[model samples]
Target: MSPQTKSKQRVRDHGEVFTAEREVKAMCDLVKDECDRIDSRFLEPACGNGNFLAEILTRKLATVKKLYKSNPYDYERYAVLAVTSIYGVEILADNAEECRKRLFALWDKEYTAVCKKSANDETREAVRYILSKNILCGNALTLMCVDENQKDTDKPIVFPEWSLLGTKLKRRDFRLDVMLKANDKPKNGQPSLFDVPEEIRKYLSINPVTKEFMAEPICEYPPVHYRKVQENG
Candidate 1:
């Protein structure tokens, strides 16, 4: 019985029952290895205040801290990847907003501890932006993201896919509907979903980053080390 639900009306209307923390941890533990993987992506279709996503972020951040504690640069890069990997779609606007806030708060607390006084404002802003894009207010059933007014204007839910290339973060946006359609087998002789030609499938297995295979990334953000900023000033 999480207090996030406004009243019995919401529960009855939306069937919104927030999972308790104890249960969230237990369920996530079942996929402990994946949860610990810093780059493993997780999407909660009906995320409510982020009980599960928060726990997943905690686990992933712990691994980030353990592996990259000696190198803040690598730690920050992978930490951002871990945050960006998480995606959520909530029908309720408040729940979607709260989920984003909760995930950001969890990341911020650990990020501050790891970076200390060396934390950069740009990096923080980057995390905020990632969360804003990752956790969206939309109907997962319809696979459409909505505007502030919660009206669907035929716009598909688009999510940015992030890949860390050395010191740079490469991002590509994909429409949810198109992604879902990638699973369908059109015909007997048709190429597989994602439009990957059969001849290229073998090559794609080795390197999936081929531009032809993925939608162009919306933007890329270079690494911004806060400690460096302070030293330069």
Candidate 2:
């Protein structure tokens, strides 16, 4: 097939053929062995079709089952551990959704097996919850935007916490608390403090700067810490 024609075809349909059993087995075995050797978590950032992830999941689930066979009551925990241990991120929303369904199907199969053997419903639902929580639609290149309109924005980047507050002023700092308090007060018994101070505005801004100029020097104060961590050994 020509490259253009081949590109149009899907490499992985549910009924698509994946031949070469021996080579595939060897590749899977290699992954399984390495995972065992290092005890490292695996991430497939661009898991286009889940060919590798499916195999890895199978081996990992098998390993978990074997390891926890004696204490079958903890089987749900084992399943959760296995599923959460492997992470995948895809840029395409469709692919990400498909990947979630694939993982959930695997979870359901494992869950049914455990529930049937344990004769319980609670464990099965717990497995469902864990699968739902961990398998998310996320882009590796960009953090998935929570805002529907910004779904395609590159790298939904967060400004560093320290950087959120631009710089400390020489006098009293322009704290978010003060800004918010100013914003909360009603207009005109005194001019609302939230109204940009005319003098400060004049000093900080140029004539044609516009509203964007008003927003340029921003600051973020850290969250109010209600509790402190213990430091004693």
Candidate 3:
């Protein structure tokens, strides 16, 4: 069994049980193809210390290293995308913080080895920002993220959707609840969840990063740098 829980009381109160490494790998293998895809999105609603997310990040980074080993520019972009694509919700404050740290460390290890002297501070900061947004401290069941104090906030859990547009990175924020409702349809003749007005859809379809289509992000981070660091290169 994975020795991940903080205490027996936590397990009893939260029903928290960390999955063993072997089992995590076995289960993720069922979706091996997706796991290997560098840009595939994954959400762990009840992530505890990021057992699943960590493995997923490792696999995606491996693909980045394999395909873009020679191109630091492409490697940096895709690696950031890989980190941005993972989402996790842990109710416990400590667990959420630990998960973020663990994931960052995992990424940094591979990044340092591959990029060597070329590592850029700005790029690393961007990754840290992305991880901060991706793994949240909140009640997944209630879809509410907590503040730094660990108190529930009125705001719903929000996540930024990242995309590479030519040489630029585009970000759009969306509510977790709204995204979850994407599949639902009302019986009455009404707009489906996430439906945009026809007039707005025209603009969104062409340029999704427009102000009209984008929602304000609940959290803020340093701007992302798209250029590759040339120190090691």
Candidate 4:
């Protein structure tokens, strides 16, 4: 690519940026408060440019600094500790890579300043693993298929290529007992489909009635249910 073409190749062409100074500060403040409140892990499903994540790291360092005021040598480990506890997911590979770099940069900045030393190979590897597992390059809207019938649509739906470091989801795991029981009951049951959950009723009442309890488009099978996916994911 020529310099001229590169100049025209813009980041905005890919996706919209959602960062604002006030919003970033508020996110950091929330992380600080939460760290104080429970001292637990955090996750970001769509960490675009690491703005929110960077702020999170900063707040975590500040909180840890105050927590271990007397013994500050551990701040380097604290910075890494904070970052390792954080997870992120980004759709774009380049953006995901960028987010990882920014995260490491922030961690290194704090680590070096506090410890007066550079990150070792071990630390770098840890950061890389964290990026590979947590900052995935996949679509959050992805749905799990129960059978071979379910597949991507004929019309290509471009989604992130990244895979999460978690257990795969399945239909049976959702435990939709009421829905399944309603499905199992014969139409002889007293009331009509209307008595079932709104979702079940809606699925049953599509204009072109489907013979199967669940309908699958010819090309795409095992239709995705967003609510189920989120719960399982």
Q: Provide the TM-score for each candidate, comma-separated.
A: 0.79, 0.49, 0.80, 0.52
Superposing all C-alpha atoms, what RMSD in Å does each candidate have to the true structure? 6.2, 16.8, 6.3, 13.0
Model 2 alpha-carbon miss at residue 139, Å: 3.3
Q: Model 4 RMSD to the real structure?
A: 13.0
Q: Which residue segments of model 2 deviate by more than 4 Å?
A: 1-26, 36-39, 117-125, 142-151, 154-233
Residue pairs in collision within model 3: 117-232, 118-232
Report the lDDT tens digits of candidate 4 across residue range 3-26.
Answer: 212233344453435577687787
Provide backbone clash counts, one per model: 2, 1, 2, 1
lDDT of each: 0.75, 0.45, 0.75, 0.49
Better of 2 and 4 by TM-score: 4
Worst 10 residues of 4 by lDDT: 156-165
Tell me the tens digit of each residue's lDDT in model 1 across 102-157: 88888989888888876777888788888888898888888887776657757767
Candidate rank order under lDDT: 3, 1, 4, 2
lDDT of 2 at 143: 44
| lDDT score for residue 95 of model 2 | 56
lDDT of 2: 0.45
Q: Please identify which of the two predictions, 2 or 4, would achieve the higher lDDT against the true structure.
A: 4
Task: Give stretches of model 3 more than 4 Å off.
Answer: 147-151, 188-224, 227-233
Candidate 3, residues 100-127, lDDT tens digits: the string is 9999999988888888778777788777
Ranking by TM-score: 3, 1, 4, 2
The RMSD (Cα, Å) of candidate 2 is 16.8
Task: Show where candidate 1 strays beyond 4 Å.
Answer: 1-4, 147-151, 185-233
